[model samples]
Target: MLPHCIGVYACGMGGAGMALATDATKIASNPALGGRLGNELSVSLGWMHPDRTMDAQGPTPPGFPFPFANTASGEQTSQIENYPDGALAFNYRLSPTLAVGAAMVPGGGGETKYAMSRTATGQMGFGNAGAMYDSQVRIRYASLTPTVAWTPSAKASYGASVILGYMDFKSNMAVMNPAFTGLPSSPTLMTSGANELERVYGIGLKVGGVWDLSPQVSVAATASTGTRYQRLDDYRDLFTGPLHLPPNFGVGVTFRASPSTDIVADVQYQMWEAVEAIGGEQPAQGGFGWENQPIFALGVQHRLSDRFAVRAGWNYGPSPIPDDVVFANALFPAVIEHHFTAGATYAISDRWEVSGSAYFAPKVTQTDPGTGDMFSQFGGGTVITMKQYGGQVGLRWKF
Candidate 1:
């Protein structure tokens, strides 16, 4: 579900822009549009206010086999005060129908820190999430991309980009002291020294094309190859060899409803089931168990005058994490499914422009069924709720 999460115009369009022709600033969406851009550059800043809450409620089964407390209730929440995802982009035309561009932008990332655990349960069980005491995980990702687009005819254009990606991670989690799990004698049953650090270097690519079917209708598609991140050689104990950014593809259409209004719709699919660190089979034992996700978005733009315009959009996607893996996803919850956005653009002069947007994702909550292996594996019924508020502003110029 992490498909191009930040862009000023795309954010106002519910993140749907595979077919919409935009100015030079909309770098995060379809790169194929570079060929149609004005010879200009822009810088943008975005803010995300994400609120994540985890709650546990359930009963310990009769033969649970642990001498911990009978039943438990716990809650943990996270708010990222300084989570800023920003970008810089420039586009220049080499010929009437050929253009090139470059951008530095946020890839995808998450971070959370908390210190709370159960009294007797320790931290290593499938129930360990209930004991999220002394737990922390962080990811920082960015990409530098150089892109080129070719317009063969006035109605068709093709584009591609080279993605230079970088990511770093650090994690510290608590686990049940091996001694408490029938290994040997120890005074404290909960041990909290499992620390892991890693960084990755990777490269990937994106290719796309737009076809204008008529004077008022157009279609576009984009495909992104997966980026295989190098293993955390320093923390082999925590991760296996390959961690990857799964491949994704998107298609969209733009309809010129009126001389002054436009409509856009797009669909995107993420191959989450293809990644190991993110998607695997045995979450009960240790798989991430994330499912493939498809996202849909629709937007409309209306021009009130020559120098003023407004936009509104809506977006939706299914949850990637099944309740089965809710226990394992406490650190990186990507459960949001709905977004509503609004934006405006103003031209101050023939060459100066300003733009801004706001979006909100209402609370979405998932509760695990505490029965059979689900209950025994999770050991506690886990409920997770996630919500977000975001805003972006930018300045642009024309040559």
Candidate 2:
């Protein structure tokens, strides 16, 4: 899945401000913050570049006659390198303690494209050999949320939003045709084939609350149900059921360390294990065998002057895919575990400001034990390594 910090201010703080109202972007992290932002609009654009490589080695699986003479031992780079991200948000006050807002936020998805298919059945083996059918998969998601925030009392606020989500999915898998293995034909093991991308939509709900314990401290919590998407009938063979996003929840605390400085900490959980399409064991359900994931983030922001401020933070989340399923998850490796971020904002005038943020994630590598299972996607003994860098810039106007 994509990183959670897609907004300019959120990215700057390593996604830690669930209890503070920064701007219209607050609609994303915690709709309850909408009532805190008077009147504002925010627009942002970002660039993300991730470098990934796959290394495969083999003593081929038992009884596997076709050893892929050309692809048996080699390293290949993923063709999918760059991605564009952006967000838009607007909030308007409806009453002394009521607010209404809307936002276009980034949901999470993953994509990968490999030049040479991993299957051993190339031209030299069985199937026609031209460019060695490419194996690729792409999935994307975005949500439009209409929210309402209510502050019935001085110390607490509540909010809710209707999550209208859209998704596009595509997959082109290359596998050994079971027809050649004296077994019944299986769509999951068929030769490479092209399939049109499918567009699907779904809806979910999100609700949150914020409470002020004291003048200098605040706490907040938010939760959302899974968005159940329409089934991708076109590639039913590659997936056991519709691809629905997993449910998630988060809690955060904001501490006003001093008048000029603030510290924020957040903890989040993703219930991937509850979603059949994402958490089920591989081969049996065509799933990635992902476990539940927990993420922790910490950020600090200090005002340097009346018109300038700077922030930095750290974010960490362990990979959800277990070592036993590495081969099955090669195409969608979500192994990034640590992120370092920094950003600054400058006021152009009383009504407008510009902000920019950048992040760096050091490289991480994972290799699967060579079990050599015939049903595994990449065959065992596959090593995947990845690292990423990205930045976002934005303009905010307070009227």
Candidate 3:
């Protein structure tokens, strides 16, 4: 079974105060907000679901070196109908200048399905060619952060926080083919599973200033640096080889568009070069060579009345997987381009609130036709495509 742990949400306008300063949530954003806390506590919960689809195609040439070869064309389709996820976070104020919090979020995960059947014609006698592959993955992470901030002056503040967490991942793969009944065909049937949990620990430091350019406008900036993590061995099998988690950084701006509305924009960088697989121990075979990536997000919040608010956001990043790693398993294609989100918050009472958000990632599909030595062995060629979708809901309580 896939891990049921939901991933964490980035620090966005829908959360607490610092959420207005930056959109980077996987890590701590504004520690100074902790200093403003009264003796109250806040708790939140959220849910998400992602759908995915894939397709592949190619041609089988006559007299090919492999079984099931004959000048014929073939195609395959695979999809993960529905995937579910959830998360929770809690924060409490220790004192006027100190706060502590914990959160659980989805780190990374995917699911896939593949099914194909083809008939060939020519001297090759490629009567029927078919293959089926299915795989699914789930990753969950929980973090504890203790924050401290000092407001030396009303307009200047400095804060620090440490992130300590553990990541749990589970995955399953199954493949079947009828063409391999003869001599030694490719493993006509195969199945495998990996469930490993790892720990991640790091520290972050932030410094910022609020300069009053005038009564109507103010400018602020913050900077930070943190440590990397080493994942578990079972999770490593999903990658090409041994891998490490890299450190990351971010910056953002908040603009007061009106007395009751604000606009925020942020740029974040993730060190994915350290990741090796979907969910397994250290990378196993040839390295996939993923690199550090950047993510951009923009959000706006408007206060319509005293107890209601509206929000919308957008995020984008590049694909982390390379094209040449031909493993041909249908777990994760990693070809998403952008995420669009919209959410709202309503006050149920003076100390309770309810919120929900939806994120849509346009499906990214790719088809790779087998070629060279591999082409002659698998009949003719292979094609592959992928797509995805995600959504979430949450509740917050303050006391």
RMSD of each: 3.8, 2.6, 7.3
Against the unseen true structure, what C-alpha lDDT does each candidate score?
Answer: 0.71, 0.78, 0.45
Task: Give per-residue CA lDDT, model 2, range 20-92, as digits (tens).
Answer: 8887887877889997888889999998888887765445544555443225537777898999887899999
Winner by lDDT between candidate 3 and candidate 1? 1
Candidate 2 off by > 4 Å: 68-73, 122-131, 175-193, 371-378
User: How much is the lDDT of residue 16 in candidate 1?
Assistant: 74
Error of 2 at 33 (Å): 1.0
- Candidate 1 lDDT over residue span 1-399, tens digit each: 363345677777787777886666454467788877879877778888888876644554344554332224367776453588667888999998889998887777777764443322544333344433334567777888889989889899889888888888776643334344442332132223244556788888888898999999999999988666777665443443455777888899999999999999999888887887677554444346778888899998899999999989999998898876665565677899999999888999988778888899999988756442442254346677888888889877788
Return model 2's CA RMSD, one decimal: 2.6
Best by lDDT: 2
Q: What is the lDDT of residue 88 in candidate 3?
A: 50
Query: Per model, how many backbone clashes are there?
Result: 3, 0, 26
For model 1 the TM-score comes to 0.88
lDDT computed for candidate 2: 0.78
For model 3, state the Cα shift of residue 150 in Å: 4.3
How far in Å is the alpha carbon of 352 misplaced in model 3?
Answer: 1.6
